[model samples]
Target: MSRRSLLRGFSGLGTAGALAALTGCGVPAAYVEAGDRSAADRSARDKSLVFANWPLYIDTDDKNTSKRPTLDAFSKRSGISVKYTEEINDNDEFFGKISPALMNHQETGRDLIVISDWMAARFVRLGWVQEMDRAKQPNVAKYLDPQLSSPAFDKGRLHSVPWQSGITGIAYNKKRLGREIKHTSELWEPSLKGKVTLLSGLDEAFALLMQGDGVDITRWTADDFHRMCDQVEKYVKNKQIRRFTGNDYIKDLSTGDVLACQAYSGDVIQLQADNPDIEFVVPEEGAELWAESMMIPNLARHKSNAEKLIDYYYEPEVAAELAAWVNYVCPVPAAREVLASSKDKDTAELAEDPLIFPDDAMRKRLAIARDITSGERVEFAKRWNAIVGL
Candidate 1:
């Protein structure tokens, strides 16, 4: 399955009632204290860890699908057997599955898991994950992209490390549109009415729109959010927006039914492979840079082993290998040089793909938006979801 198909929807935490239950006024007990979050060290004896992640998010052997080259190397090098499961289909579903045990101060039967940063904020707020030891992860400290090191929700990345990074930006069929779209505001051009789509998920859609209005997304106010929503509401009423979508926009754009739409950088990479006319732009106004992050959950028995595995992927060579397959933004900037030096022509060319290793100029336009706070999630999700009719 395509990565877009597995990762696009935000329905896992879509409902206001569910948002309330997870993040609203009551339920102080849902917050785990630091003192109670850790379990006794068993890594020295067990030498194994269970890692759960989204489907198609990792690199695999091209010939024998079962062979994961990098993962196998990690196991061989560290002697830490990994039981990796691609079981986290959605953030909310996975949360629901393991939350019962976590809330009750029990093992989640897994050491580490990956989820989007917005959802990672929820886990960080509730302290459902443990702080990683940077001392044990020197490569992570040395090579992690500076842009991803500090997010509002996890300053200095105390509890999480990005597995892969991507941009949420405007994508258009340059040939079909007969013009380039340089700004988010261009999506609203009269000629483009009924031919443009926006992402339906509230979390996925809002920041890019706010950026178009010249809002500084890192510290945007509720007024900024509401004003952006007001504009979208007007566009929706007038039929300017073809529809709010998930990855389905890929099909629409590909078939020429939709000329341009909000798109994920990774999906656009795959699309451009089949149709180079399709182009993803990090708007002049700016775009939201996001990550699917890895976290070691509270009371995980293999915390030490998990830390080593996280650090291992941070090695530039290993990161380059993964980036070559995934085609998402690599969180380790140094990996670009590694790929550029590859003897394989196609692999060497990936080093120049801005979508994967964003140029310095492009980096200036990318910002990690501030996360929605637990207190604000219910109210904001209610308003945004109402606009998208979710």
Candidate 2:
């Protein structure tokens, strides 16, 4: 059985709607006319495509950081050369860099870009991305995880396909804590009090807390949220929670300052490479699954070629190659078999790691919370930010 998804909430900044909310920049009324969203496909004429993604996000040669093998293979197979750039670091900064052109209904000068699904939500709302031609992407339709499709931001995933996926769960030092944390509520156990930390970001913390409340987070309500806030606030006042945190929770967990904390699955996987005592759990209640996705900006000159590249990566062999390096949840489950059969001991070992390939029991506990709408964002952020003291 498949699992539910978690907050399609924004990653770095608040909802990708901050600018749209503040200035009404990409409000529905401000969006480009639907007819204006497409630029003529120029894949035939250009024969070259540009893709901008986050750093270390794809497979590369160990000795030569400049060389990317999977993209090279695409260039060789499809004869569509790619100019890949890892220029995006933060979602908001990249948004500021390219929003001017997209808002003006001009090409963003690149054919493809990857960003958190929440940020992609803003582009979809603004009519800044083209509806993908599923006909050209057989591999994507066949291999894209069904759970990731039809997010509130892009129903049926017409505008985005996840590049990689990760979970927001709990990580702890089992030896220091002298126990296993089996559920989100366990963070508040008296033994762990003042040694536990929750994520400081509203988007980051809300879904897990809601799950801990026994709410079905797929349809969690505003009341569910405020009630969660009431509990977290109580924890704060009682010092049950040491403090809310960002990725900084990693260091604290590492140093024994924090015995347990809410954490990203990917970060804990890397941390365990150095310190094996650290443990990551998909709580008995549930955890959030998020993705940074790929989309073609509106009016991109190489839409067809871009679509082919997206489909190419979805092929299990290709996804496995990328998954081996990135170590995020493999969106293409078929990739697990490929990795399991690999000759390299390290690569094959990844196939069994539940964080990279969640087992059936864990899958049931993963939930994708609905994203806060632009209106709800203003209201929710005020309440949550105050609690986190942001």
Candidate 3:
């Protein structure tokens, strides 16, 4: 069995809605007031943190459903009990759920939360999340990936830290295709007509497609967008593309109903565990490196405990445990060595998997595409949804 992040369903709804809703605004009047933003330090009183995140994100022991080893260890080590809640299924939906409280300068009741970095960009931009005290997070400061540092939205990652990072690339069945795919452009070959799928969301799809056309996604232009849109629209017209898809592409690809598609690195990793013939490729042109990040919401009551929990995960041993189970790109490079030295053979082999722990060469080719700005979100989504019919 393979596990997948709910990227297509929840992320699509939230991202599409979020981008469309937030535009040309300095900060909406609904934003949390600066003066009312800080909640009194409640760590001394509570000694517990509430964390909201996506389902199946953390490592869970197979035998025991309730016990989460890493989190339990954190609780025991720090004497801080964690109230973990898998409440964040979609970025936009979670924002809708919590924004009302934030806008009114009230605690959302969740001390910590995780959402895709693109959405994290919005929260950071709106000052909805607080700056972490780097003095307390030495492990995160030292172990965080260099490429992930200094995002345009959160320079130096003062407001957010990546919980897990992954890549957006092409995943294809090698036995079905009968050849290795080295570049994204090859998905358009005549043999693949009506058999290839792209992601449905504009943010998820545009970067890789643009990269296939030889654009540097880190600094792609509006013109670059329209050019790619023109190409995709043409492909749709000719039925060269099977259809725009969400995470559903995983099922289609696995069943040999679709040969290849735009996919997340984490999903492909699990896919390979069951179907070894399935291969994920970082195309010669490149792929987008993305992260689902952690942020402390404005006026969150257990802020200090939450910060402690965030740094706890950054410890190399803990990070290695997470990387072993979730199989995303490990944000802590030092954790690779920890996994490599593991006593468990299956766990140790994971350290060598390029998809899980991308080597320097692969890292050089992986770029975090610049996020779609609030100003461009509406126009871009309109054009994108028009073509994809989402």
Best prediction by lDDT? 1
**Candidate with better TM-score, 1 vs 3:** 1
Q: What is the TM-score of each candidate against the true structure?
A: 0.96, 0.92, 0.95
CA RMSD of each candidate after superposition? 2.0, 3.9, 2.5
- What does candidate 3 score on TM? 0.95
TM-score of 1: 0.96
- Sort every candidate by lDDT, greatest first: 1, 3, 2
Expressed as tens digits, the lDDT of each residue in 175-274 for candidate 2 is 8878788988888889887999888767777888899889987788889989998999999999999987766787799899999998888888888998
lDDT comparing candidate 3 with the true structure: 0.85
Model 1, which residues run further than 4 Å from truth?
11-29
Which residue pairs in candidate 3 have backbone atoms (N, alpha carbon, C) closer than 3 angstroms, thus clashing?
Answer: none
Candidate 3 Cα deviation (angstroms), residue 5: 3.4
Which is better, 1 or 2, measured by TM-score? 1
Each model's lDDT: 0.90, 0.83, 0.85
Compared with the true structure, what per-residue lDDT tens digits does model 1 show for residues 1-390? 357556555733443345456455443337899999999979999999999998888899999988899999999999999999999887777776787677778899999999899989988988899999999999999999999999999999999999999999999999999999999999999999999999988788889999999999999999998899899999999999999898899999999999999999999999999999999999999999999999999999999999999999999999999999999999999999999999999999999999999999999999999987766777777787787877
Q: Rank candidates by TM-score, best first.
A: 1, 3, 2
